[model samples]
Target: MQAMTYHGPKRVRVENKPEPRIEHPNDVILRVTRAAICGSDIHLYEGLIPDTRVGHTFGHEFTGVVEELGPSVQTLKRGDRVVVPFNISCGTCYFCKRGLTANCENTNPNADLACGVYGYSHTTGGYDGGQAEYVRVPFADVGPMKIPDDMDDEDVLFLSDILPTAYQGAEMGEIVDGDTVVVYGAGPVGILTARCAWLMGAGRVIMVDHVDYRLAFARRYAQVETINYRQVDDIVLHIKKMTDGRGADVCIDAVGCDASGSHMHTVLGKILKLEGGAPTAIEWCINTARKGGKISLIGVYGPPWNMIPIGTAMNKGLTLRMNQCNVKRYMPHLLEHIRAGRIDAKGIISHRLSIEEIPYGYEIFTKKQDECIKCVIVPPRAA
Candidate 1:
């Protein structure tokens, strides 16, 4: 099998590797059909995530065909097309029972935070991801959802992560009718978050990013106001002025560690490694939100620390919420939205490449080249 093998930071290539086999009673082997490179994957590719070992594949948003099933998996069988959640969760756990599958205790019990996630890093349980021709899925009964026969793989591939994550990001904002929501970052997740905010009855949505293409795409796709943060002298002040000086009712940070705004944050966090990934977007969210406003963080940040504006948040009595999205909890509801044509989830895909183009996919996405918003990898075998 050919897999995206990691050598080091900014180094990945397609190479022949042993195909995964069922290793647990609840495990199944999937011939990966569609694997999307997430923005967070760039963190791993750039060697930001701790213990992202060389030779490990990095992908989580994928859909595959169940080529083989483990003995204990009774609900699914061979040839079942499924989209597996990135979180490797055990449904019987306390957290899973509460619909918090991302924190499933039974999986990744050794970790202090999130449960086993596919190909994130050793900190997230060291499970290899699906950026290859095939992947092994464990706790099969709990994670993999069967795709509707009428739908194509492209139609629901994001159900594995970003779609539900975007929806969850907006839900955390606790938006009410006529509330003004400002989303920082106009990437795939940010744009999707803006769309979800409107669906939840937000009267207005504003998406911020330096990339003109992405901001324009957000305006067209999510129908939200767009701001090129780079053009403004002060993003916080500009947003404050936009919201009539009171600040937005809700602010969302969708651009995690890679956020490129504050020089102080970038130098301390990304360069000096003093804090965790740069909290530029989080800082903006805290500084620009109205008093008693809600802020939702759906961005991926690394461990250790982030220099956040805690004093400002406390002073303003802002409500903050954040978590890796519990993908299982929202997949069914989102699927309905997709089916009804209320949300064109697949429209976010801007690039599709074969397994051989894995490295290229990562390159264009990281460089934000070719007007790319999202890239999906199709393994040659599946192609």
Candidate 2:
């Protein structure tokens, strides 16, 4: 089997590796068909996430066909086509029972925070991801959803992570009818977040990003207003003016740790390693939201020590909600939306490369080159 292995920061290559097998009674072995390089994967590639070991595989959004099933797995069979949620949950834990699978206590019990997530760093549980010809899936009955026979792999691949993540971000905004919403970042998640806001009855949706191509992509695909933050002297003031000085009713931070707005944050966080990751986007969200407005953070943040404007949030009576998305909770609902043609989830894919070309795929995506918005990796079996 050929798998994408991480060597170090900005170093990855597809090389022959041993195929995974069923380790637990509930495990299943998947012959990967489609996998994606997430924006969050860049954090691991850049060494922003802690405990990301060399030789680790780094992908979580994937769909595949079950090649083998463990003894206890009764919900699926060897030939079932499935899209596995990134979060590995037991489905019977306190958090899982409450539909908060991202914090499942039974998975990654060694960690105090996030539950086990495929292909994330060791902090989230050192489970290898699906950026390979074959991969192992645990707690199979609870995580992998059988794909509809009428749909293609591309149509459901993102339900593993980004699509549900974007939907959860919009849900956290508490957007009401005729509410004005502003989304920071125009990446895949941001674009989808903007689209989801409209479905939630937001009267207006604005997406922000310094990258012109992504902003343009969002405007065309997500059908929302876009702001190129690089052109403005003060993004906070500009957003305030756009909202008639009341500020946006809801603001979302889809750009997380690697945000590149403030010099101090970049220098200290990315360069000096003094802070977790840059809090530039979160700051913008806090500063630009209206008093008593809701702010949703769907962005990936590493350590808890990043500097935040807590005083300002408290003073303005803002509502802040954030978490690693409970992807299982929204998969069925979003799948229905996709089936109804309300959301063309596959339209966001800008690049599709073979598994062997993953390194180059990473280069173009991280550099924001070739107008790349999303990149999917097709293993040989599916290609």
Candidate 3:
């Protein structure tokens, strides 16, 4: 099988690799139908996550059909179309019981270190990922959700990651009826963040980004107002004015480490120029947040922190919620929403290509070309 393997920094390749088999009795193998490249994949490509080993496959956002099942996997059989949750969790764990599947203790063999994840690294449980011809799904019964036959792949692929992540951010922000919410970053997750905020009854949703194309897309597709930080010198002041001087009631940071004051200061230096001054989305959130408001962070982050405004948060009495999404808990509800036509998440997809064209797809997606919002990799079906 040809799989996208992480060889090293700035180097991922489509190479022949061994096909995965069910190693655990509870595992099931899926013939991948569609897999999307996530922003997190860029972090790995840039060597942000240490778990990415040479030859490890590189994706977590995917949907597929069950090709085979382990002896104990009775809930699903071959031919079941399913969306695999990005996180692998054991339903019996304490964290899982509390709906925190991202921190499941039992499935994370390296729990003393970090939560285990598919196609991440040995530190993240050493499980193989789905950016390949097929994948072995650990905790199959708990992780994979059967999708309705009538639904398209792009509509529900997000249940695996971005959409749920965006929803989680909105939920954590405690967005309520008539509240004004501001989301930082106009990436795929940010666009979905605005959509979810509106779905939760937010009166006005403001999406912040330096990229004119993305901000425009947020305005058009997500049904939210957009602020191009580069074009506006005083984002905080402008947001306040837009909200009648009360500021945003809820602020969600979807840009993660890419924003100013983030650990990846060097990267921010590169992209911030497009948005003018420092790319301080986090700072903007603090400056523009209402007192007692909630600030939710769903962007992927790495080690060695820097330049966060603790005093601003303290003075404003802000509540901070940060972490990865517990995709398991929200998968069922989000899938229903997709099937019911409540959300048209597939609109975020800007490109779809065969697995063989992954290199080209990565080039365009990495450069974020032609208003590229998201890219899906569809491996050719087995002959």
Candidate 4:
């Protein structure tokens, strides 16, 4: 089997690797049909994620067909089409029972924070992801959502992560009717979050990003206002000016780690390794939000960046909420939305590549070249 293997930072290649097999009673061996590279995967690729050792395949968003099922897997069988959630959970655990599937206690041994996440790192239980021809899925009954007979693989692939994540971001924001919302990062998640805010009754939505193409895409796709933060004198003040000096009713940070606005943040976080990640978009989120407004962080920030503006949020009495999406909890509801023509989950895909072109896929996506908004990888099928 050919799989995308990590060699070092900004380096990956397609190489022959052993195909996966059922390792646990609840496990299933999936033949990946479609897999998407996530913004979170870029963290591992850039050598930012700790313990993302060489040879580990890194992908957490994908859909596949069940090629073989373990003895205890009852919910699925061979030939079943499924989209597995990135987070692995045991459905009966206390956290899983309460709908906090991301924190299920029984899965990850390395950390108590998140349940086992596919292909993230050894830090999240060292599970291989679905970026190859075949991958293993553990606790299969709890996480895999079946695709309907009428739908194609592309139509529901994002239910694995970003769609639910963007939806959860909007839900966390508590956007009321006529509330003004600001979303930072015009990447797929940010654009999707802007769309979800409208469904949640936000009267206006504005998106911020440095990229000209993505900002243009967001404006057209989400029917929202756009701001190229690079052109603005001050991002916070500009957003405040737009919101009549009160700031937006809700602000969302969808760009994590690599935000481009702060020199100090980039120098200390990305260069000096002083902070876990640059807190630029989050700083903008805190500063651009109205007094007593809500801030939702759907972005991936791995470690503690001591410079986060806790004082400003505290002083303004803001409501801040953030978490990894509990994908299982929202999958069914969001699937219904997709079915009802309320959301176009597959519309975000901008590029598709074969398993052999995985490296090129990474290059264009990481470099933000070719107006690439999102990438979907179609792993090769063996004869």
Worst 10 residues of 4 by lDDT: 299-308
Q: What is the C-alpha local distance difference test score of each model? A: 0.91, 0.93, 0.81, 0.89
- Top-scoring candidate (lDDT): 2
Off by over 4 Å in 1: none
Instruction: Tell me the number of clashing residue pairs for each predicted model.
Output: 0, 0, 3, 0
Question: TM-scores of the models, in the given order?
Answer: 0.98, 0.99, 0.92, 0.98
Backbone clashes in model 4, listed as residue pairs: none
On residues 1-383, what C-alpha lDDT tens digit does candidate 2 reach at each position?
Answer: 99999999999999999999889999999999999999999999988888899999989999999999999998999889999999999999899999999999988956587999999999888999999999999999999999999999999999999999999999999999999999999999999999999999999999999899999999899889988988999999999999999899999999988788478888878877678789988999999999999999999988747889999999999999999999999999999999999989999999999988999999999999999999999899984
**In candidate 4, what are the lDDT values of residues 1-383, reduced to their tens digit?**
98999998899988989999878899999999999999989888886667888899988998988999889998998999999999899999899999999888888996556789998978888888888999999999889999999998988999999999999999999999999999999999999999899999999999999899999889888999999988999888999999999999999989987666467877777777677678888888899898999999988876645488899999999999999899999999999999998889889889989888889988898899999999999877822
Models sorted by lDDT, best on top? 2, 1, 4, 3
Candidate 3, residue 140: how far the Cα is off, in Å: 1.1
Q: Which of the two, 1 or 3, has more TM-score?
A: 1
In model 2, the Cα lDDT at residue 173 comes to: 94
lDDT-best of 1 and 4: 1
Stretches of model 4 off by over 4 angstroms after superposition: none
RMSD of each: 1.0, 0.9, 3.5, 1.2
Sort by TM-score, best first.
2, 1, 4, 3
Residue 375 C-alpha lDDT in model 3: 87
